[model samples]
Target: MPSFVSRIVPVYLRIARANRPFISTEGARRHIRERTLRPQPYGPPRRLRADVAVTVDHDRGWPIYTLTPRTGQPHGNVVYAHGGGWVNEIQPQHWALAAEIAVRAGTTVTVPIYPLIPFGSADVVIPAFADLVLANRIQYGEVCLAGDSAGGQIALSTAVVLRDEHQVTLPRTILISPALDLSLSNPEIPVVLPTDPWLGHDGGLVLGEHWRGPLPISDPRVSPLFAEMANLGPLTLFCGTRDILWPDARLLVDKARGAGVEVDFHEATDLVHVYPLTPTSEGRAAQAEMIAQLKTALETVRR
Candidate 1:
């Protein structure tokens, strides 16, 4: 039987969904404008206080936000990628989370603004991220790559590419509600559709189409579930049972395990995708748990 909070969670999600458009429209538009009109040389500083810097990637410029610890030399660095279905979101919300992990794990965090789709290709963006990792490897040592949603896909793909193509070694990776399968035909979609407040099948399809362009939907780079994970680094994946991507997350875990890779998989009961970004108490708790898990993973990497 479902708990009382479980029952109420869906109801609250529905109410939130009804109001999301009005609540998010202005902020979304503002973000779009800032992402578009901001000069390439100058990256916008987030409201949060962190060491902000910009690095040039080929012809394009990328922002790197570094959050350092108060005590102790950094254990390792985390390269955090922000999620927006490959197009719509930015790195503002990630700053707080990055700081939390940095302090808890005694590490520094470097968050790069990877080029979103339609504007850049995964081939381009992934290599740029790899370059960032390679550039900082000496200062940061072994790095843990982390991201949510589409950003998660990028993180994992970049790790795989680095290991396989560039012979680079990443310590580990953390994925939150990762969209590993771009096919979007997973069996869990319908099961969680009624309760997911932020994303829908139609929305995913539209976004997928926008990002894929001329490529086939099954391209392994776009969908890491189909990619080779044989020698990838240890991975930690967090997904809610009520999320549409839960099935894909599970499948990815199974594949990683079968390939003899270490994986830490956490499935939160009765929660939705991107739950950490929600403003509810559940969201806060989820974000806290995520930070804890990331801290633990970083500690493991350091040891």
Candidate 2:
């Protein structure tokens, strides 16, 4: 059940309606970067118990934050990527979530500050992630990749690449409100257009332009929807009915199913994009639900 505040918070809904007609892939990218990229306030400072280090890869520096259990419990490992339309660094919110997952799952979490958009591609960041996995091979079992929004796209791409090109077996992937289609042309758009809260036609267009430079919108790397999912591993997707990416989520599920991939789709009613970021009661409840789903998904992979 949604709390009173969740029911009354109309900002996300209003933003969606106001920006609906003009939503384009490029516009969405730009709007997200502009609105969410502002420097986050320095959160309560506390050093993590896990080891932190930086590695230089192909002339670019990648920061890795590793969190391990204090009692030496062995568990699965996850590589988490932060979402900023691929244009922003890992923020405090990401760090907090990473910490929670690491502690609760009794696993080490490796967060790679992947290069953002307008400066990098999935081709660039995916291999860098694979390297991190290889370097830390002994630390984790049943490797899983997870992320939200654009980070979800990166995680999916990395899993695909690792399985196909690297022959590295990643058992599972968890995507929260993934932005899989850069083309923004899902057939369900008309039906989902009115309910989405944070994303709309206008914002999407702004974002798409910034992320895709000279490349066509249908490029497989830019739009995972067009990519071949034949060999992709088991997948779990969490989405909000009111999210602008709702249509994209549905399209992905259908395509994945058609491709013979095992997909678990969880859709929440009347929720907005990135609702887990909020501190409201509804947000906490949703977060708990997602975490439980993630645990079950991981367990299935282990089996």
Candidate 3:
């Protein structure tokens, strides 16, 4: 039942093995130590190669890059958090995706180079993100939050924090293969662990523990699934059945529906984690749905 692009299956499997060691407790410790030692530079902005309006400013306590198309006025704005499992640096895929979203959806997309774990935890990262989102919301008027994997967690959590503590509201949230439950202690996870070619069950839990810092792993701040699902924003969630986090995605869907929130849930059988970010047919379809969601949020704000 797990259907993925045949050609990429082997590549994904190799990635899984390469990442498997970090699934252990010791692996997490060692990775944090190593990552801290070799702090990665942001390199050149990917948008520089394209014909888009790009600017970087540290007005929000840290550098935030904004990308806009040169053709037309943007419909709305999006603040995307890049995923790195809370420890890794932002990949080129993230930069390319941000640019694509800007061009396809006809919206300016702002990506913040947020700090990762050990260097940044719930206490430090979330507040800075909240400020960034709030500032964007005020500027853009109707901002939609979006991210993949760990970035997805931050996107969701930042929205919740602004709503609860800062009294700011967002239009919607888009999460692709989000690690909603940091504990990764779900009962049904073992069922998919073997079939999941890109994620390890134990490694995810170890990373989650380290990422949560002083907060309990199950705390709503770290695990948005455990948080009240009522009013974060309109939700559009995408996950693959083969992803280890699919079960948690399902649970979050149930909770959101129970809270009378509108949700557009898209689950593809046998797709890999963050399939929407991939350059396959299924991935394109998923990206189209996300663009539609962003457009819809723009309409809602316009009304």
Candidate 4:
């Protein structure tokens, strides 16, 4: 059960129709059109926390942001990918979380503002991300990949690509409400979507078409949910029962466990999608757990 603070989110989203862009084909098209016509600024927030230092660089044209704690040397590396259905820019909330991870966990957090759909898709971004993760690993000795929604899909796919192509696997991965299958073909989704305040299959399919590019909807490149899960490192996954993507998370947990992957799964009985990223009390608790997980994982890397 969700607390009053967290449970109120659904009411707000439902009243505001925040799911409009993700629930209808026309709504998605109009939203994307408006964004293309009038682009919003992307990257680190203008007024970032003073305790963290930010450096920006480019990797094959993708903007990579490295955030370090101003206090002292960081312990490990975290590459955070922000989710936007593959077209949305990084949100202020993402920057806040990255900074928190950098400071509280005492690790360098790298946020890659990968190209959106119609500009670049999984094919170009995943390999590039693998290279970035590799670069960070060489410098820091270990790297953790993390993301939410489409970004979570990319982060997981990058790990898979690293394993298949480079014969290397990341040490850890954190996926928050990951959009597992772009195909949106899960029969379970229809049942869950009705109660989901902020997502719909029709709009998701449209965004999926743009995000998959040259690959099929089920391709592992764009949808890692279909990929093999063997030989990967431990995973920290969070999901809520109210989201359409919740069903896929359950399937992933089963597949990953079957493949002998170590999974630390967190499920919210009444919360909505990405509830961990919100400003509610449950979100703060989830963030604290994330920091703890990063600290424990990074401490091992240091040793």
Candidate 5:
């Protein structure tokens, strides 16, 4: 059974309708303008934990945040991307997860603040991020890639670009409720659409078009669901039945496994989108598992 928090999240989202902006093109445009014009420390995320030290840097003119634990020197490195349907900025929840990974997994986490849609798109973001990952791997000797939702798409796309274009193989990539196919064409999407309190198919396509830029909806650069999967590192995926992206997550598993790429998928039966970030039992467990995976990679890096 879903925990109480799990059950109430959808109700809260319905009430907040924070995701309502993505329900239509006009709302998305307006939301983008509001965020871009009046940027603050965060859009609508919770306060970050004080256990870690966070510093901001820049790479190729994009802002990068590095979280290092107060406990000691970090043993490994993680490069994270934030997801907000390709339009939203990094939230405090994203920072919380990055800090958690940094402290618990005994690693330093670097999160790149990529440009959102109308200002940035896949054509410019992917290669630049891939280069940053490559530079991180060179600096740390080993690193992990992680993200949620659209950020997940960017992380996986970075890994793909690293493999096919840069000839680098990552050890692991963590994906949470990733938007594998921006086209929102999966038949299963509408089936879950009603259950999904936050995402709307119509608004998704509009944002997809903007983020996709000149690429077709099916292009591997924009929709990693169509990317070649061989020779990449292991993959870990998380999704819930309440998210419209669930079908694409399932599709990614099948495709990745068919290509002989190792995949670990955690399907949250009764949870909502990006449940791992919420303060729920299921979310905590999912995060615990993610930390353990990062620890494993960190261990390997130490050897």
Candidate 6:
């Protein structure tokens, strides 16, 4: 049986769907304009445990946040990209997760604040972020690429660009509830749409168009679901059956495996989108597993 929290997810998802218009382009534009005048959304940053030091810097003019634990001996590095459906900016929850990963993994984490849609598009953002990750690779040797939702798309796209265009190879890539196919036209999507109350197919499709800029929706940089999967890296993905993106996640996994790429996928039955970020038992467990995977990946890089 699903947990009690799991049972009520659809109710909240429905409520969120009803309130979705508030996050549309018009809404997001207004929110972005007024966001500066308003107080910080994540509240004042509290102190992080484990003596981890957090600093903000810039890479090629983009904001880059660096988290390093006091150990001063990181096993490996992780380059993280945050997800907000290609339009929404990073939230307080994302900051909290960065801190947690820094403390637990005791590794250096570099989070590049890539531009959101309306402000920038895949053509502009992907290369800039690929530069940041490439810098990490040069400085830290092999590094892991990680992200959630749209961030997941960016992370995977960056790796692809590095591999194909720059002849760079990543050790691994991890995606959580990634919007692999921005078109959201998968036949299975409509079958699962009613169950996904948090994400509207119509709104997401619009945002995807805005992100695509002059490129076609099927461009590998915009929709990695269509990208060549071989030689990318070992892939790890997490998604819930309740998420509208679930079908695409499964599709990508199947395609990657068929191409002879090693993939570790965890699909939680009936769970909502980005369950690992939630405050539920399953979410916490998933997070723990991710951390463990990070440690193992980093350790392998050392050997």
What are the lDDT figures for the candidates, one per model?
Answer: 0.70, 0.67, 0.81, 0.89, 0.87, 0.79
lDDT of 1 by residue, 1-303 (tens): 335565566687687663232124353444345546652332434455444232324333855656777667777678888887776546556666766677766677887766664576675777778878877787777777888988888888788878877897566788889888776899777887765666666557655655565667777667788887788878878887777788889999999999999998877777767656655566676667766666676677667
Ten-residue segment with the worst summed lDDT in candidate 4?
34-43
For candidate 3, the lDDT comes to 0.81
* Model 2 lDDT per residue over 218-268, tens place: 655556777788778778787777776888888889998999999988776
Q: Write out the backbone clash pairs for model 5.
A: none
User: Which has the higher TM-score value, candidate number 1 or candidate number 2?
Assistant: 1
True lDDT of residue 112, candidate 5: 86
**Per lDDT, what order, best first?**
4, 5, 3, 6, 1, 2
Residue 65's lDDT in candidate 4: 89
What does candidate 3 score on TM?
Answer: 0.92
Q: Pick by lDDT: which candidate is best? A: 4
- What lDDT tens digits, residue by residue, belong to model 5 across residues 1-303? 899889999999999995677678788777777877876464223357778888877646977878889887677689998988887778778888888899999888998888887889998998998888888877876889999999999999889898998898888899999988888889988899888888888778888989898878887779999999988899999999999999999999999999999999999887899999988999999999999998897788688
Q: Which stretches of candidate 3 lie over 4 Å from their true place?
A: 1-7, 44-49
How close is each model in CA RMSD to the real structure?
4.9, 4.5, 2.1, 1.1, 1.9, 2.6
Task: Give the better candidate number (1 or 4) by lDDT.
Answer: 4
Clashing pairs in 4: none
Task: Report how far off residue 194 is in candidate 2 (Å).
Answer: 4.2
Q: What is the TM-score of each candidate against the true structure?
A: 0.80, 0.78, 0.92, 0.97, 0.95, 0.91
Give model 6's TM-score versus the native structure.
Answer: 0.91
Task: Spell out the clash pairs found in candidate 1.
Answer: none
Q: Name the weakest run of 10 consecutive residues (lDDT summed) in model 3.
A: 1-10
Candidate 6 lDDT trough over 10 residues, lowest sum: 35-44
lDDT winner between 4 and 5, please give it.
4
- C-alpha displacement of 194 in model 6, angstroms? 0.8
Q: Rank the candidate models, highest TM-score first.
A: 4, 5, 3, 6, 1, 2
